[model samples]
Target: MGIKSSLSKVFASFVLKKIESWKFNAVDAQERTLQKLIAEAKNTVFGADHHFHDIKNYQDFKERVPIRDYEDLRPYIERVVEGEPDILWKNKPQYFAKTSGTTSGVKYIPISKESMPEHIKAARNALLTYIHETGNAKFVDGKMIFLQGSPVLTEKHGIKIGRLSGIVAHLVPAYLQKNRMPSYETNCIEDWEQKVEAIVGETLHEDMRLISGIPPWVQMYFDKLSEKSGGKTIKDIFKNFELFVYGGVNFEPYRAKIEASIGKKIAAIETYPASEGFIAYQDSQTEKGLLLLADAGMFYEFVPADEYYNDKPTRLSLGEVEIDKNYALILNTNAGLWGYSIGDTVKFISLNPYKIMVTGRIKHFISAFGEHVIGEEVEHALLSVANEEGVEITEFTVAPQVNPAESELPYHEWFVEFSKAPQDLAAFSLKVDLALQQKNIYYFDLIEGNILQPLKIRTLAKDAFVNYMKAQGKLGGQNKVPRLSNDRKIAEGLKDYIK
Candidate 1:
């Protein structure tokens, strides 16, 4: 093993001790983290207003600060952006991580130096924990290709503004940068297609042992490599490849295709990372859910998913949570975001180990006709059909057709881009419809009562979603197709390219 690999192994051994300790006592750890954050920021503008100094416990904290989304905290964020001091954090924010916004064009999230270590540490410990459990640290001896946004950051109000990946790229440790793939010039290419093509060229011959990216973009690179090299699989080009570390989106839908591209089975790691914070990661190979980082520099609160959209929601702490109940996550982070709704919904799969599976997003749902359908339900139904039919899905989205212009009732429209189209498309559609109906009673009722027409399917041409996203200037990285929309906006937008 190389010197770096040997040292990393030694460090991983040390971090394993910490992770094991934190895993079992998640509730206590989370309480302590919350206390620490309250104490540290007690004198800040927000803290003073919320009476943070007087807060003695989680109950006190909840009562003092109201749970808020980005819109609620926009005034404070604007102050910080205007170069105000001690607005949210103790110190001025050094950077802002730009991310996708719902109504707004872009969201600029504050990133302080104090909170940066948590992002770095959580990622490092996740890998170490994986190695500790699986005993698979050999990949550390070779190169790691991190497919991220351009490293060149854009500046706004004298603060660096860029995608989280790009910000993370600038923070890559010197030791690891030597082993990282793709030159700086290649990563700076703004167009995703051009950048990925250049990345394929630069890293195709390197001794790449580990690869990390959002699954769809990684799949694109894999396809490009296969086409250019005339090889059956990615393994043929990069023989030393061992691990695929992925985040941002679900990996199950892309798993079969990824494995097929590699031409062999390889170990994988999943991380729950977002612009708000690095929440959890897969800690053990045998574990079903990613272990939540309870002590990782953020205070967490949960509101039952159904109640999240209500005027006043019930907030529950880590100790108050139960397994299998979907909850929308609320975070108060070290980075100055107080009572921030991160918008993610999750369900605890393992209470003993404090592990969770991300279920969906709060804003991303379809409830056009009281048949509320979530991202998780959609994903599960699609995966179920894909598995049963022995086919692979490339991508898919669902939008409600609320009006029937012709001779039918309003119903859901499914636009699917299939990597391997099932031999019988109608049969596949029927299975999907049935699976969805079985999962959601309201949807089933709508179908049974004939108030809604049968779900319609439109098999999209190849790269249909990709072309759509590119046209919107959101082709890659953290950008993703909204899986479910309540209106016909997304469905009608995709109609032009429907086959």
Candidate 2:
């Protein structure tokens, strides 16, 4: 059933008023204010036998139990997956999300009905906050295009379900939703090629106003739309949209192409979401970096970037978190997940607890030769080169490789497909290399002797990695290509193609 727009709008208005009342309330208390709520969710959803007897505060709770991760609740999750009734947790997952994080390999994460409220509420709060701040949501009448997974899971009979993008498609407030290409309902295509075709078929229509998804997928979607119309842009297809919201990974690479395709100064909203929980988001023009959903029904902990690998880590509340420093966020959410490290890193952009900017992923880094390089550093460096060269290459990936043939020189290789090109490779590569060095002092020292040189930029046809991920049976959903990697295997394997 389609969501009633009037009713949803009324509810949204009410929700927005309440969120505005928060006023950075996430830092009002040193202890979690929603401990009772999280406890209630835990006992009701997980069927927990034990209850908090004496703990009166966050510190007490911290002392009583250690933090946790996904593996910690294998027993409960296993039961939920098997569809066991009357389990401690209440929400049965509609479907498991396909995510391959640092620890979770080829993993299927259950999205419980109970846990989803937190995700939805937090996301709503962020979106509303954006509206309140920008005063421009009315531009499209609250009709949004979210590039999320389809609700249908691809299963036997080869029935094609919406990928993670499809799931989000179903989850949005209905009037904002569309029957865009590759309807998760009927797209029996699982192969990326097939799925892309299916989505392309639907996207060719002119009704798709406002789009959201990982930048690559959105880029691919636009490329398909353009191809279908023989050089027409998204502006020609869904010319009505005035805003574009995207997160998951950096969208800077494709920012130019996206703007050109849309033919306007598209309002870009960046969000920070993880499998464990949706941590922070920023769409509000008044604020920079995403505001951590600090006041959500969750207890939070912050581990300084340098101390993430510490033997005995010290955790802090939002108030205690420092500004401009990176931290590995820890959360004790309503889902009964505690001390769960969501893996995404962030920077505090403001004093308000909710303000943060996603720095990068914890696992996706290039440090093969002890020269630690991450997403933001590489992205900024590339942007600088692009600016210098006056080119727009939005799609690129970086991998660390030691070329044995080149006397085992540890070099950073970049595979970049450009909408525009820099004036010179030699100068651009040196500038990128210096930028990386200046960003990471350690990298600077390592490259001082020319032991490791600058970056390599190579082009690819628009849907190159899209086709690659599709070939691996990973094309249809939340899955995305890693932006940076330390693994020599992935580096060497994708190297030839980078050239």
Backbone steric clashes in candidate 2, count: 26
Runs in model 2 lying further than 4 Å from the true structure: 1-13, 29-34, 41-52, 72-76, 83-98, 101-103, 125-127, 137-144, 153-171, 174-189, 406-408, 449-451, 455-462
C-alpha lDDT (0 to 100) for residue 269 of candidate 2: 73
Compute the lDDT for candidate 2. Answer: 0.64
- Model 1, span 93-210: residue lDDT tens: 8789987787755777998887777888888887887777777777887889988887778776677888888888888778788888888899889999999999989987889999
> In TM-score terms, which candidate is top?
1
The list of candidate 1 runs beyond 4 A from truth reads 155-158
For candidate 2, write residues 72-169 as lDDT tens digits.
65666667556654343444455455566456555445555655666767766665655555554543443344545545555422222234444454
Best by lDDT: 1
Error of 1 at 473 (Å): 0.7
Q: Estimate candidate 1's alpha-carbon lDDT, on a 0 to 1 scale.
A: 0.87
